[model samples]
Target chain A: MAATTKGDAGRSDMPEAMGAGIRIVAWNVLSLAIALVIWQLASRAVGSPFFPAPMQIVDAFIQLATRGDTTGHSLWEHSWASIERVLVGFGLGVIFAVPLGLLMGLYPKLYAGTRAVIEPFRFIPPIAWIPLAIIFFSGLTRFAFLIFLGAFFPIFTSTLVGVARVEPIHRKVGIVHGASKLWILRHVVIPTVMPDIMAGMRVGLGTAWLTIVAAELAGGISTGLGRMMINYAELIMVPHVIVGMLLIGLIGFLMNEVLLLIERRLFRWRWQVSL
Target chain B: MHAPISLAKVDVDASHRYGPLTVHDGLKFSVAANEFICICGPSGCGKTTLLDMLAGILVPSSGHVHIDGTPANPKKHSISFVFQEPSTFPWLTVSENVATGLNIKGAPSDQVRSKVASIIDIVGLKGFEDYYPHQISGGMKQRVAIARAFATEADLILMDEPFVSLDQPTREHMQREVLDIWRHMKRTVIFVTHNLEEAVYLADRVLILSAKPARIVAELPIPLQHPRDPLSTEFTEIRSKCVQWLHASH
Candidate 1:
């Protein structure tokens, strides 16, 4: 009886559930269509070449897909460049940050001792390190370094908070079962903090993507959507620049959606929705 | 397996203090192997604190707890627990949660699979083994906790008011199931509860404690056969006796 209530808790009434979903989809489409129409009219009225209308941006998007960018690199190539950097940086950040965060969380004295060193770097924006990155590193290393800086803090902090917030009973359960320290760390601590770690990784991916784009925009990278945008802007091809911006926004949204999907699948036991 | 394992003889002579406030004042007790003991006390009487001492989660300020003539070390003796809260690991499915203790003890995969399968069956959670904790009702989650504790095959199992959160009917139902499991497993259990009927129904003997800075006020043996009826004259007689002793302590 209780199980049925819990299963029904978040669901709409049977008759209304399907209707509600359709209504939501219709409303979203209508809202976006209305906004685009308004923007197109406003841009035409202004008649500034730099402010391309929505249709012009769409035309440029198709052109980029078929004709390639100013440097002859296709749209897919630019996107993959930025995406590969984000994944590499984000992956490396997670590998190092999560274990470090877990260790710091488990031992308070270690966290306290390292706070002075870690806290300062976290406050510094990734963009501010561009000059240093360019000077000390070359090629992919330079981009990876900046993107790593952007992604590392969120993942580390989230894991630390996750560890700290772990239920005392969870640890006691492990201890009572005669779990060794390593055993408890693996079975109890890691599993208990998984949701938080996933949350951190999601946020870190966003920041890493942002940092990679910024680094590409700052130049030295011949590829990526950001570099493609700069190349078009230099030639004053406003429509192509708008296309690059739109593509970045679309990809970021898609990336976040992918992570959200994974989160939903992995943590089906959690009560609240991430959104 | 129905016979006692002959290991879990617990001797506790301990006192605990949280700064200036004393929680257990020279509290001393002993539990025999396979004996089902219930520690009943008033609110804020530190029944959980006593269990923590027994579990080795908290060390007594001034005395020792020995299991089978050895010092109470969780690493040395297989001690399992069932907490009042919903403690099934949320990330693990029902079967995985039950297998936790055995997995930690490095039991072979085949042994873990069979033991977990049978324990889940005993607890009436056979079909729900693939489900997560949030998918189950609170009573069902408690059953999982019980199954996990039993599957561990611990020398001693500590239950701190493990059914206090359930509805009355569910609580009574769990009490009967717990008795059934105890009969088959023969693991020494020290259950702590404030409910008089619960203490009377489940325990071979009940230890009643006084108010703050608690001490054992009385120790009453149930002496009744298995499947004791709650409405029977003998059951109420002992319950009233416990109430009198509890009131007198205050």
Candidate 2:
């Protein structure tokens, strides 16, 4: 829609979202083209068996997407497996972390009681827990546990900070309005911190995705992107390994975009600093 | 014999200290039902701190606030505090902001709608009800604040220099708006401001306080007519007297 309001900075023929979309797609294509050219030139000059040209990696990826290739499963299957682990781990992390974090933010005493346990545990790397996770849970649950460990603390800490950042005066307004503790949490506290919570979910999901790939290699999982890369590397299939790495990066970008879309839909009132 | 109406009170040597220095001490006062009172003092003399104490946001180290002989409590009596700073919630539109108190109180949807609309009109914000805080100017946000305060019809409204941030013209305009709402609603209001003229213009009684360790220095009563002419002899006489007390305390 062409804006009728004054002082709107006037519009071009193109809608703002469309204009921004064109610019982003143009930049992405140009950058990817340049990178592919550089990789091809570098590989042709070096002439090493270790490094494959961009075309070879794309062919390997196409092979995975079309047929089972060496892994006996399509690329879709590996991607889906990785995504399932991330979803389960991220979902479990959010279900417990958000409420617990909010409670801790509201009540310092609750935070104090749990601080000692969480503080030391958060410092340990998620991959370090692979041994314990495998011992505790078998198969898929073990991989999920590693992803959960990666996702939990970031979401928890972000929620805690966001809740604590709510303006004191806003709470006073709720208090004076006779809003109950529960009512205030729902209406006043939650809305104020929602943007942060959504952002944390995006971050936590990304972390879980990254952790899941690493966990798959160590957790004896045979059907994920990480496991596929390991299997190919053992066979000295360099192009296949590069294909797995690139797919992980592409999928990660797509997941973040999905979360950003949701964040924008939910928090319309929030204004981001733009160019 | 029982009093006809119960009002709120603040007494019992209420004071605050920052380490060694005291901000207020022996600050005792009481307000009558439906009265418009102003606590006037020098700048940074803890006028806002006094309102916070009454609103239960800040608990006085020693004294207590009472409503109808019971300690002043938000759960017991409806109390609203309007801060001097523009306190409109940015995420909520004007109508939503005004409707919040009523919605929290569990009013019917129709009642909330009507009350919000009526109060928005009363505060001269009918058209801007859909506007967010960022979409409007500072003074309009003040109107939203007023509408929110009046809509609640709280037993007591504590205002800590609510219009002090506006420009001179808008400040005067808002002062009259506040007086109109206070008169029509007949709700007890304890306004805190550093300006003597504003105190004389709006308050039925002005509680003048000392500079530091602010305590009630004097209580000046104003029987002046409504829509008071600032240039009139009566208004200036009262304003000057309040000013003298404020200066002397400083």
Highest TM-score: which candidate? 1
Q: Pick the candidate with the highest DockQ.
A: 1
lDDT tens readout by residue for model 2, B1-250: 1132435454434778767878788788888888899988888788777777677666777767676676667777778778787777878878999998888878899988998998898888766776667767798888888889878777789898888889999999889988988877777899988788888999999998887888889999999989999999989998888878888888
Q: Candidate 1 lDDT, tens digit per residue, A1-275?
A: 12433334323244565677799999999999999999899999999987889999888989999999878999999999998888888888999999999999999799999899989999999999999999899777888888889999999999999998888889888888778889889888897788889899888988998898889999987999999999998999999988888888888889889888888777766775476
- A32-56 per-residue lDDT for model 2 (tens digits): 8999899999999999989899889
Indicate the docking level reached by candidate 2: acceptable
After superposition, which runs of candidate 2 have C-alpha atoms over 4 Å from their true positions?
A1-14, A47-49, A273-275, B1-28, B57-64
The pairs that clash in candidate 1 are: none
Provide a comma-separated list of chain B TM-scores, one per candidate: 0.97, 0.93
Which runs in model 1 stand beyond 4 Å of their true positions? Answer: A1-31
Q: Residue pairs in steric clash, candidate 2?
A: none
User: What's the lDDT for residue A210 in model 1?
Assistant: 86
What is the lDDT, from 0 to 100, of the residue A124 in candidate 2? 91
